[model samples]
Target: MKLQAVLFDLDGVIMDTAEFHYIAWKRLAEELGIAIDREFNENLKGISRMESLDTILRHGGKADDYSAEEKRDMAERKNSHYVSLLDRLKPADVYPGIRELLLALREAGIPAVVASASKNAPQILRALELSELFRFVVPPDSVPRGKPAPDLFLRGAEEVGAAPEFCIGIEDAQSGITAIKAAGMTAVGIGSEAMLKAVGADVVLPDTRRLSLEFLRGLLSA
Candidate 1:
C-alpha cells in the first residue's frame, strides 16, 4: 500500500499541551465544586471541549444541574484558561523527534496534517513554530463529530486527497485510535502499548520519540 497522508493528533503527539488542558479543566471543575484529578482527566482525552465539561459534570453527578448556557459559559472559561497557558509554549516545546519526523515526511513527498480534537490546533501549531510543516490543520468545527466518530480523521484524509486506506493516523488517546480504525486507516498510537492495544490501535509506540518515517513505511508495507 502506498502512503498518501499522515494525520496527527496535536495535543500529545505533536506537543505536550495535555497538561494545559488538564489545568484548565481542573480549574473549571473546582469552581463548579466538581473535583477532578489527573486520573479523571484521562476521560477527557480526544473529546471536544463541551464533551470534556459534560464528562466532568457527569463525574460529579451534576450533569443535569446546569443549563445549556451555563455549560457553554463554563466551557468558555476553561478554554480561556487553556489559551492563556498556551502562551507559554515555545518552539522547543514540541515533542522530541516529531519535527524530524515531519521533515522526513515532507522530504519523502508525503503530506501531513493535524486531525486534532483541540479547536486551538492552529494556535498550538503556530506556537511550536511548526505551522508551515503541515499541509493543513483540520479545524475541529469542520467535522460534525469528534473522536470515536471518525469524522475528523476522515476529513484529514479528504483534505489531503488521500484514500482512508492509504492514510496513517497517529494519536495518544484510545478514542482517537477508535476513530482512526473507524475511518479505515492505520492507527499508530503514541502512548501506553496496553492501553492503546485495548482500543484496537494497529501499532503502539511508547512515545513520539519512537515515531519515524522508516517506522511508518514499515506499517505501510505490512
Candidate 2:
C-alpha cells in the first residue's frame, strides 16, 4: 500500500477552467448557429481538442464531413477565444488545499504529475507558476487516444516512475475515472461526490475542503 505518486486531471481537479471552457465554447457554438449550456459543456470534458471540435459539430448536426480548412478554421477560432479569456486567469483559480496537497506529497517523496488532454496545459501550468510542481506533463497528443481509454494516465504514471497500483489519480469527470480504472490505478473524484459515485469513482471528495496532508497520507498508506 505504499503510494509512489499522484496523477491529476487539470481542468476540474487542479484548476477551475471548466467555466472558461463553457463560456468560450458557448460563444463559438452560438456563432455557428448551435445552442449549448453549461451542462452541455460538461460533455466535452477530458477530450482532445480535435475530438472536442468533432463532438460539438456532431452535436450541432454535422459529421466528420468537415473540410480540413473548415476544421482548422473552427479550431483556431475556438483557441483564440479560449486563450483571450485566460487574460483573467489568476492563482485564485487553483483550488483550495491543492498547494498543500502537492507540498505534502513532495515532502513524502511522492511524485506528482498532470495527466491532461488540453493542448493549452503547458501554457496554463506556466501561467500559474506551477509548472515545476509536476514531474511531467502528459499531453493528450502524445497518446493514441485520451481519457476513458487510459492511454494518457498510464503514460503519466510512467513519467512519475510509479506503477498504477501505487499511484492515485484525481479527476472530475466520469470519463476521467474510467480512464484511471482502465489504467489499473485508484481514482479520486473531485467536484461532486454523488455525481462522481454515479460515474463509478473509487473514492469521491466533495471538494478540496477536507483534503489535507494527513488525510491523503492515511489513504495512500492504507
Candidate 3:
C-alpha cells in the first residue's frame, strides 16, 4: 500500500461536534456579553478547545483584558460546557462511511490514528466507541504547537510507526490543510469539495460518505 496509515483530524473529521462546539461557544460568548454569530463559530471549527477560546477572546477584544487566572477560569468553564454537550455525540453520529473506511485500513494493516488539537479528543472517541480502531491518539496536549505548525501530524505519524510520506492526513479547515502539507504529506479534505480544493488539498471529498479506498489510491497517484 502506498499509504501505510491515515491520520485524521478529530473535531470535524470523525466526531460530529461542530454544532455542539458552536452552541457551547455561543453560550459562553453570550454570557460574556460578546457578539458571536454563526460565522464566528464556523471560523473556530476544527481548532483545539483552548485555541478556540483564544480565538473567541481575541475576537471579543477580551484577550488583552484577561489575566492568567481569568484565561484559566474561562477555559475551564468552556470545558465544562463542552463536556455537558458531548452526550449528544453517540455512536450514531460517527461520520458516514467511517466504519467501513476504518475497517478497510485495519484489514490492510494500515493503522489509523487521530491527530487533533482538541483536549476533548479522548471524550469524543469514547463517546463514539471507535477508540479501538485507532493505533494512537495525539491530542492537543501531546504537542507544544498546534495546527498550521505541523507538529501534531508529524508526531502522530511517528507515533503510529509510519513516515509522513506514507500517511494521508484528512482534514477540513484551511489551517489544517496547510499543516498537513507542511508536514510533508498529502492531504484529503473532509468537507466541501470546491473550498477544500481551493486550499490545495490533494484530494477533496464533500464528506466521508461515498469515499473509497480507490479514491485514496488515486490521491496518492496524483
Top lDDT hit: 1
Better of 2 and 3 by TM-score: 3
Q: What is the alpha-carbon lDDT of model 1 when measured against the actual structure? A: 0.92
Q: On residues 95-202, what C-alpha lDDT tens digit does candidate 2 reach at each position?
A: 888877888877778888899888888888877777877788887778898888999988988876889887788999888998988898878888787878886788
The local distance difference test score of each candidate is 0.92, 0.83, 0.83
Q: Per-residue lDDT of 17-106 in model 1, one digit per residue for the tens?
A: 889999999998889898988998899888999998888999999999989999999999999999999999999999999999999999
TM-score of 2: 0.93
Whose TM-score is higher: candidate 1's or candidate 2's? Answer: 1
Top TM-score prediction, candidate number = 1
What C-alpha lDDT, on a 0 to 100 scale, does residue 25 get in candidate 2? 81
Off by over 4 Å in 1: none
Q: lDDT-based ranking, best first?
A: 1, 3, 2
TM-score for candidate 1: 0.98
Model 2 accuracy (lDDT, Cα): 0.83
lDDT of 3 by residue, 5-90 (tens): 78899877885777877888888888887889987788787667677888898898888877878878877887798789898778
